[model samples]
Target: MLARIFINRPVLACVFSIVILLLGGISAGLLPVAEYPEVTPPIVRVTAYYPGANALVLADTVAAPIEQQVNGVEKMLYMTSQSNNDGSYTLDVTFAIGTNTNMAQVLVQNRVAIAEPSLPDVVRAIGVTTKKRAADILLAISLDSDVNPATGKPYYDALYMSNFATIQLKDAVSRLEGVGDVFIMGQQDYSMRVWLDPDKLASRNLTVTEVIKVLREQNVQVAAGQVGQPPASRGQDFQYTLSTLGRLIEPKQFDDIVLNTDKNGEITYLKDVSRNTLGAKSEDIMSRLDRRASSGVAVYLLPGANALDTADGIKAKMRELEPRFPPGLKYAIVYDTTPFVRESVHEVQKTLLDAIILVTIVILVFLQDWRSLLLPVIGVLVSLVGTFAVMKVMGFTLNNLTLFGLVLAIGIVVDDAIVVLENIERWMEKGLAAREATMKAMEEITGPIVAITLVLSSVLLPSTALGGLVGQFFRQFAVTISVSMLISAVNAMTMTPALAVLFFRNRKPGKHAEDKEALPWWGFGLLGGLATVWLLTPILGPSLGLTTGEGHGESAPGGLGASLAGLGATLVLAFPGAVGGGVLGWFMVRPVNWTLGFFFRGFNWVFDWATRVYGQIVGWCLRFSAVVLFVYVGLIVLTGFGFSRIPTGFIPMQDKGYLVTNIQLPDSASLERTLEVTDAVEKIALETPGVAHTLCLPG
Candidate 1:
């Protein structure tokens, strides 16, 4: 079957190669590249605050009812809730790891029906997370007074500057490519904190609730209907519609806000009792840069945004806006995530290159011929290039796992090429012409190679249908390996045979000119002896030596019989000691590290003592031979168990990025506080050379 392929399908093979190459290139351009997929789906969190409820009470009234109603969801994991002393209840429902969040959310809402009527009306608003909390580091924002001359102070510190900056910065960041949302926090603006005198409130017959209600009502802005527009004045032959609304621009507006009437029938306005003022809100202490009071803002990039480019864009914008900041204040980016991504990619690529070179050198050394090396090399290249195209078509990313798969598969792919090439070489060395050799090689090895490839691919094909985070992490790797292996098989069947027929005649296995060399006398003698052993062993039932009942008389004390008996006894006795030493060594492995460190400090002393001991026993031939043989046997035993002791992993870690950071914080910490701590740590991170972005989240 394969001989026909080698004989007649050369043109088809060439055409297929061209088509695969083009398709792969196109796929490479279009595939999405990410660190990992979104293995975790949408998680909805509901939090309710009850100022005086205990944990037990909160659990029974608020948590239990919600759980029962939200139970029995098809794709839901479970709903878990916790209560605290402050009377807050937070219920978290985690869906099945990869379930579609949008669909699951609808099902969850419908299930919560039975519990809705039992809740206390006093329970504050239930907060549901509409979007997933992302860990993506989008853009880093910095403000510098030195760069923008028109600005008076750090916008982050200046109340007016911060107010205007928030509006402008938020607007600009939204325009950048791949930006999901922009959040600006940490700037405090003017707020009226009414520190009312209890006595004054009693005397005025006013309650706290009444004051709050009037205050809220006075701060309102309502939209009125649009003012009338003339048809003749409107553009494009149509009348335009414009809505009118009242705007509150200053704190003085509150002074004229009317309250309820006094006993004397005069209107009691806000100006009657409390003094109106504009001052900074009652916020926590302001932070600083270089000990000068300053504020900072952060920008989170969209999930799919390229970290490097987004960071560059932010830095460029800062350069343009620096001149607008205040004097004595400076701004700088504390951390960015781009450099880390770049470094990780570079390290993986470098290791891959080194692996390729090593594989090539190995092929050359083992084949010991140029043509044999070329076919497998070409096969490897074709397989890898084809894999890239498949990845592009499948929208897979070039991540750590995927690259690792490629590295591992590189060795296995060469196995097929080697099998085909070796078989063809064997035929050629037997004096077959190139065409005949190619046909014979394919005919003999094609089935085995295809079967092996299929077996390997089947082992990994199940990964594509796996569930949860583990599946998302490993699926791409499995795909890469399976694809590469299949391509290699194709290459072996097609390109390898084709190349062999074209180049085999010119590249003979050895340099000797003789067409046939006669087998040597020793070779024939060895073959005859092996044949004799095979034919006799089966007939004689594997008996090389037999203890026959032909002992005539009792042997003398010093004869051969006594010596053989002593030898057997000695061998039997030595087994126990050898086995005991091995068990002792196995148990002592834990102490080896500390012991080696100790002896390394005194290695010279130990070596000198051993040398003197060896000198004293140099002429003892029996002792020397026994010691050498014992040491060799001990080594062979230890070698057998070496694999069990050493730590085994899929692959050895390449020396590249080891920059992993772990952070911990107490529970109930707000996002604002978390960002504050993260910012401080980021300063230290950015100050260190080669340190890329710092990522932080609440535990």
Candidate 2:
């Protein structure tokens, strides 16, 4: 009944297809592109610092208290802590896969507050910092200074570069949409340092405790009151406010601080026993870009955020601040993970296009008519494109898994159209008119089409019910394939019959004269032109790097000449094969029909032979049903054994076109020694084949 209505109203059927295409196209643009869905567990990190404390002391005083408080937070899957020798304690509390990251953080924060009073006084004073962020590092931005022409050294040192990025760049980037947090590697905030001379202090009979007390007292902030005449006894009223320097901003101010006064009326100043200077808070960590002193800013993506868009926003923000950068200072994106994503998506898109083209050619060949090919081609477009709308509604992204499903669906979706079209064609061959054949075909095959769609969808939909990260990974894939299948079934019932009625003709048998027509000269010209460009691209396209140069007195296989020769050979063979076979039928008309006829006859013969063999096997299986069942059971058992032996993982490992190497040294290793080791590592990495760039962060 649905097919009958659409067969009569061909325009309405086309409108339905157009609507699907429009919705799919729009949804595709709006869908976020990613390498994978959010499979990593949500993590909330608690970090704290304790100056002059070793890893063991930090573990006891800081890590223990925080972990104890945060251990059993709601939805928390597990917790891990690291206490570094540099007085840094980091605790990562991981929640279940789908837990709300913000809620987890709040819960962890509430627990930490209860444990704060039990922590050391210094730790409480320093305060613990909590952050919610994805575990992956989206990208890294490096800030380096240019060489000084006069001295042949960097105009700015690593300390200056690190502080500059922390002050100017970090906050701005953190404010951007989709950016969870920004961290400055090798951070060095400016601080006033007092170099106390024990000898001089001993000579003056001033203890270190006395010096600290005087320094703290002198640097304290004072809130001076206003001087007003509001309540003064009659006469001129004048109001004034008094101001005083609260905290010392310069090192010289600390030098004049009075330390102690003795009975002899002798006063000693802080400058007498100590020297003051402004320097970095810590000089333990150093960053380098290609062996030059630099700072690295690592950016993290928020949970469920689009990484490509966030990376672009970070880059644009950097460009906007480029003009304000200090002289000789510049920034570069040293490491980014988005390029792999972008390239993977592009490759999938190419594969999708190739699949569409291959499907169309196969349909044209099997149908033996250009007009008949439109049924399946249109069916594929509508079904696959419409799946995007379903994906958008399901909160799925255009990631690798979903795209893989789409690629597989191309074959599945085309099946519905072929089934309907073949049924209608069979009716037409039996001396029925186009409309009558379509209506009769729909009446007979509509149930089968609907059943096939449901069966395929049911087979895949069960995967969506899986648990945990594996479920998240396969859910989108299953949904995508099933949605496309459903849409294809609808298209087969409605559009396939309508298009067949419109595209087919009502002709008596043996009317070959009217079907045969002259081939257009322009069609041959277009094919020839395309073939010429395709053949010449290997030779003339320098971007292809197809050089005809000799290496070690041997001709390069990938050279232009060899590439062109190979291309020519492929075209010669393929033109007579599947793809070009259709082209020849389109352009050569009756002249090439004989050749196509002979090739197709051979194909039909092989297909028939295979069908006969399959029929014989089916008959044998029925005759020996018990034996066949036993063999099937044995095969199932074998499959289970093989599956148990195979390695299992959440996802296959992909080379993402980059590598990360973590180098650890002994706890007693000096900063210089760490740098020496890192320098050696960086040099080796740079010299390694396929290594394009390297960034070093040594502490």
Among the numbered candidates, top TM-score falls to 2
Look at candidate 2 and give me any clashing residue pairs: none
TM-score of each: 0.60, 0.78
User: Could you tell me which 10 consecutive residues in candidate 1 have the lowest summed lDDT?
Assistant: 547-556
TM-score of candidate 1 against the unseen true structure: 0.60
Model 1 ranges with Cα > 4 A deviation: 30-74, 78-93, 100-129, 133-166, 170-199, 226-245, 263-265, 275-331, 361-374, 389-396, 429-433, 455-475, 499-699
lDDT of 1: 0.62
Best by lDDT: 2
Regions of model 2 farther than 4 Å from truth: 1-16, 49-65, 84-88, 112-128, 199-217, 220-243, 260-266, 502-654, 687-690
Tens-digit lDDT string for candidate 1 (1-699): 754574566677667766776666555544433445445444555556564578888888777777787777777776667876546676667776656655766676665555667776556244322232234444444333332446664434445434545765667766766454554434555555455556666778888789878876766667553434443444545444555434445556766777788678988766666777766552333333332344455666544344444555565566576666555545666444544554565577688778888998777555544466677877887887789888866657666677778888889998988998888778877877778877888888989998999999999999989866777768888999999999899888877787777766665554322322122223333444444444443444213222211231111122234335543544444444445445554555336534544544365467678898888777574568988788889998899799678887633565433354655657767657765776677578768887643433222
Give the alpha carbon lDDT tens digit for every residue of 241-272 in model 2. 78898889798898888998989999988899
